[model samples]
Target chain A: MERVPVLKIGDILLVSIQIDMEDQTALQLQEDLADRIVETGCHGVIIDISALDIVDSFVGRTLATIASISRVLDAETVVVGMRPAVAITLVELGLSLPGIRTALNVELGMALLARERDFEFKDIDDDEDDADEAVVAAS
Target chain B: MALSTDEVGRFAGLLESNGDALTTAWTDAVATLLRGRLSHAELHRQIAELQKGFQSALAGGAGDLEADAAGELRGLLSELSNTRARQGFSATETAVSIFALKEAMLTVLGQDGDINATTLRDYVSFSAFVDRAGLFTFDSYVRAREELISDQAEQLLELSTPVVKLWEGVVAVPLVGTLDSARAQVVMERLLQTLVDTGSPYAIIDITGVPAVDTQVAQHILKTVVAARLMGADCIISGIRPQIAQTIVALGIEFGDIATKASLADALRHVLRKADVNAGRRGAGRRES
Candidate 1:
């Protein structure tokens, strides 16, 4: 009945899985993270798996599923703190987690998310600037 | 077919008395096999020590060569085989040393002026014992040589897969020689460790020194790229020669979405572009601040 705790920092949800996950627990986590993403309307999620020593296919798939679901919820997911051994194993298992963004650590993960947020803001500003130019042209 | 204590004692005494003659014959045989390449004095010294050990052990233990008495002889033979292997002697040359001692011992026994069935039986058993010892030496020499070969191979592997940091946020692994599975594993582990240690976002795998790129090699390269990608660092495979590109296409091996370049220079230019983007971002942030 153990659950992975999800913490919210500003609009970012941080999930540091400190223990090995049971199959049921991993499934439960997928649900919990999705619900939290909607409830908090977070802009980014950083799932830290540095403490995870072994990532079997089941856990790898669960991670990929979580990243995909978070994307659908309008939140960017950055999986961070993967040990080198785990990364090698995940590749050998042929589960590259293609859609998930990854970073070296939580700090870098946060920086990446902030950079992404900056790009999003700049995109919105560009749209506004174009709208202003159009209004002036029409007048 | 066990020799009585009396016969074993007589054989031991013969070995002790004719030790120099036996050493001479043994060296002569080894000289034939080695084409006189080895130092005669060193060969003589080794044979003298082996004869001393063999005679003493035969006198102390039971008459049978198969008993624990031959343990010392086995040890001597093992050491001799190991030395010969390291000294570049062939298996036949090493076994000749023991077999030659057997022949020289028989000649000494014949000169003792005893032409009887029991002595001849003892001689035959002794000859068989020496043959067994020669075979044991040959086995040890082969094993030692194999160990030496494998050790050299491991050192070569460690030498070939060196990951170096080219810039602050970039590392490169220049591969040479063939890309077998074992070397591929080493390359992947070393490159991944370097990526983690440097925290470099870019890795350039230069395969210019690689002789050819077959399907299996392409698979290994792709696996390494995927592994690096999972670790959050992108990999750029460089050194794609025209022949290798044609081979890859002919084999229908897909490199997936990983980036490839024709040369290291092109790969470096690609990394610099990305590095410039990052640098430009930091500069923009500073300007705004």
Candidate 2:
């Protein structure tokens, strides 16, 4: 199976895919990229899939999972330069890339990552409380 | 064997006619036998017997069609039993957590010192963990304890805190506890909603229970006040403890044009005086007319 290539730029890692996603290969590529991101110890990652013409459910779900897992590891992930057609296709398929950060280009994504680090983190205390309350109510 | 042709023909016709009656009689006899064997009471007994057999077959680990049906029933029963057991466990855990929180609060109060932040934080964490484990009763208990501490803190902060009917507002909310971003957001929404519902020109918010004032809390308060003003209501901040005041001044946080009264009574007086002035103006106009 053909796989996407992962590129490293200093502390930021870039994963780029050129193939039109039509099969399970796309999902496999996503998993491989996620695994590499964990092993590379990169602080930030930018996924550039501008070359792909179509994005389907498997690809979208994989990206969302990768983004969520990256957050758990304290690594920031950004999806960059998504083609308009691919974006529309994904939306039409009712596939959403939740939890993944998106930017028009890699430069902006890197800038955002830097700014995020500089800002004082707002603690999600309210969310934690709500979750606690929900748990309690469930019990 | 040597019969006349007419006699044989007549005999054949008689046999054909009797065929229908004979078939009917045979059907009736078979049906009667079946009814005796499968009467309502008898069928009920047979069904009960089948159920017992199924249960035994399942227990004996038989794997035929009958056993499969029994296995499915057993699975369903086991699932129901497990769910009930889990529910019972959760209820018990909630009760235990509530008790623990109450005990912790009593112990802290018994010390007769200022509310220890560290101790309170520990209790909050414990309460949160219990809540996550599906103990909801403990949540209310924890909230109540926090409210008690907040009430005390408010009293200590300003003795002159008064209940004020600012412009006949329907609901007066006395906020207590540390206002994090999320809590602040909730407070903001609640105040705005109350203002919209009552259509009051003024709302007196007694913040005497607040132990600390952070930048986030200050911003939230400002946002609430501003939003209320936009909706044609004034938000009055009252019962400012000395420490909170000191914190605000030290941090150089600004409230801009928002009104901050020392007490709710003062805030109420301000609104009532405005109402009186408006009423006086209307009376003068009426007299002239």
Candidate 3:
């Protein structure tokens, strides 16, 4: 079985998909990505898809799945470097990949992820206050 | 009446022997029909060439014009019709040019006197041949005219849709004419390609030049906005004239989350604000450093 290598740079996991991924490879990558996020405690994941020329509905779904699981694991996922043609194709295919963040390049994606992480930390603080209010009501 | 082989032989001989007289007569008849619309010198030259070509084509088939299956004469007629079409000649005028040859041939044949049955048979066969050539010319003319019209239409479509970069990270496309599906597809591709080339995060689609907003037009705009969004760029649709806005609302056409402005300047202002926010953030960072 082929596996996409996930490299960690600082607290971010970088995954550059360089091949036309089969469904199995995409699913496997999604699982592997989640495992790495948990094991390494990465705060963000940037998937570079500049080399991905074509993406079908299955691949698009897998990307959305990966992003959702990463968010649940408290990791921000930004898929960067989508070609204009691929973007058009995805939309025409009715797969807008909602909730999956994207950027023009890896540099911009990194900045976006960093900024989002700051917002997420602030959100966590607000959630704690809401949790306290719920506890008092229950008591 | 069909000509016997001998009658065909004599007709071919007469055309060759009287080539100059037949050409001059043909040119004169065409000049009257054309009414000096084309240059006389050029018209004469073209008529002379046709006379020479017709004689050769006739001789090759032994005056049996229909037997020349390779369409040697028809090729010449098509060329003439195409030229006339481009020169703005009407179908009637083009077809009449081919018919004029019949009058010229009959006049030349009568100069010698007394109409005999054999000569009459040859004349009838030649007249049928000329009629066939005239119809062929009309067919070619219609096709050529249609091609010319379509070519101009395509050029107009290209001229109307032009994408321009307005700011460092903003591009604008001002559209004119109806947003038919073909034109919409072209506009979408050109705008998307420009977005990628400029790496612009913002796009302003100005519909001020557009005439009306119907349900289909609204759909085209929505599709373009969705496609742009998928490329990670925000789109602002401008030029919502009062009447157009009313129509859109009446039609219950929803634009969803895409931004709409009343004018290009307003759209520009909106784009500048968004672009500046990113720039301002970087500027603030530099100041802190």
Top TM-score hit = 1
lDDT of 2 by residue, A16-53 (tens): 77776655776776666667667656667777765666
Query: Over the stretch B4-56, how does candidate 3's per-residue lDDT look in tens digits?
Result: 56765676788899988988898899999899998788888988887766777
Q: Please give the distance, in angstroms, between residue B210's alpha carbon in candidate 3 and its true position after superposition.
A: 1.5
What is the C-alpha DockQ of each candidate? 0.43, 0.01, 0.29
Lowest-sum lDDT 10-residue window in model 3 chain A: A130-139
The ten-residue window of minimal lDDT in model 2 chain A covers: A130-139
DockQ of 3: 0.29
Model no. 1, DockQ? 0.43
TM-score of each: 0.89, 0.31, 0.84
The superposed Cα distance between candidate 3 and the true structure at residue B30, in angstroms, equals 2.8
Q: Over 4 Å off in model 2, which ranges?
A: A1-139, B1-171, B281-289
Residue A106's lDDT within candidate 2 is: 65
Residue range B57-167, candidate 2, lDDT tens digits: 334444332345345534433332343333343334324422332343334344556667754654454334323323333343344445655776657434332223344
Sort by TM-score, best first.
1, 3, 2
C-alpha RMSD for every candidate: 6.4, 31.0, 6.9
Model 1 chain B lowest lDDT segment of ten? B280-289
For the record, the alpha-carbon RMSD of candidate 3 to the native fold, in angstroms, is 6.9
Cα lDDT of model 1 overall?
A: 0.82
